[model samples]
Target: MEDILKHNFAAPNQLATIYYMKERVEDGRSYYTFEYGLRTPIYATTSFATLQVMADSLKILQI
Candidate 1:
């Protein structure tokens, strides 16, 4: 998991995934692992104005 985060993350966009597995022993055991990543084209917006613009453009495109 850390391996994937170290190898795949860049600077911007982020991603994560988790998994759980069970194993049988004298008692049952469960383990969990996770990975995360960052890439490009990610945006940090303070308002919905840009989203509204995108929605309007998509509506125009549909016509």
Candidate 2:
């Protein structure tokens, strides 16, 4: 959505945004033991791809 792109996807600033999203989901967001919420896999996959791009950019800079 536009909100995510504007608020969380800015270059240089998106690194922290992506990191925090991953951390929050991993550490705080609870998953049901027997069930799960409606997860749009396409959204999850796209977000991950974006994060991967960010990480790869950082790695290239370190070389």
Candidate 3:
């Protein structure tokens, strides 16, 4: 799996196929490499409210 450095409060789902999608305010959203050199956006969320907002926003895109 491609090492993904996410916020301390972030969380990832059980499936190895999913993970915390790394993003930024400057370059907008971006993709991170995971297992098998797969590049996919994070689809998980942590209990942290701040992080939750970012994760929730992803739903709008149906990602």
lDDT of 2: 0.27
Worst 10 residues of 2 by lDDT: 30-39
lDDT of 3 at 40: 31
Each model's lDDT comes to 0.28, 0.27, 0.30
Model 1, C-alpha of 32: deviation from truth (Å) = 1.8
Q: List the residue pairs that clash in candidate 1.
A: none
Per-residue lDDT over 1-63 for candidate 1, one digit per residue giving the tens place of the 0 to 100 score: 344333433332434332332222333322232222233455422211110123224211110
| CA RMSD per model (angstroms) | 17.5, 13.0, 11.4
Measure candidate 3: CA RMSD.
Answer: 11.4
State the lDDT of candidate 2 residue by residue for 1-63, as single tens digits. 234443443343332222223211234333211111122423322233222233224211110
**Each prediction's TM-score versus the true structure:** 0.18, 0.18, 0.17
lDDT of 3 by residue, 1-63 (tens): 122223222234333233344433534544332221122374433321112224435322222
Span of 10 residues, lowest total lDDT, candidate 1 = 44-53
Off by over 4 Å in 2: 11-63
- Ranking the candidates on lDDT from highest down gives 3, 1, 2
- All candidates in order of TM-score, best leading: 1, 2, 3
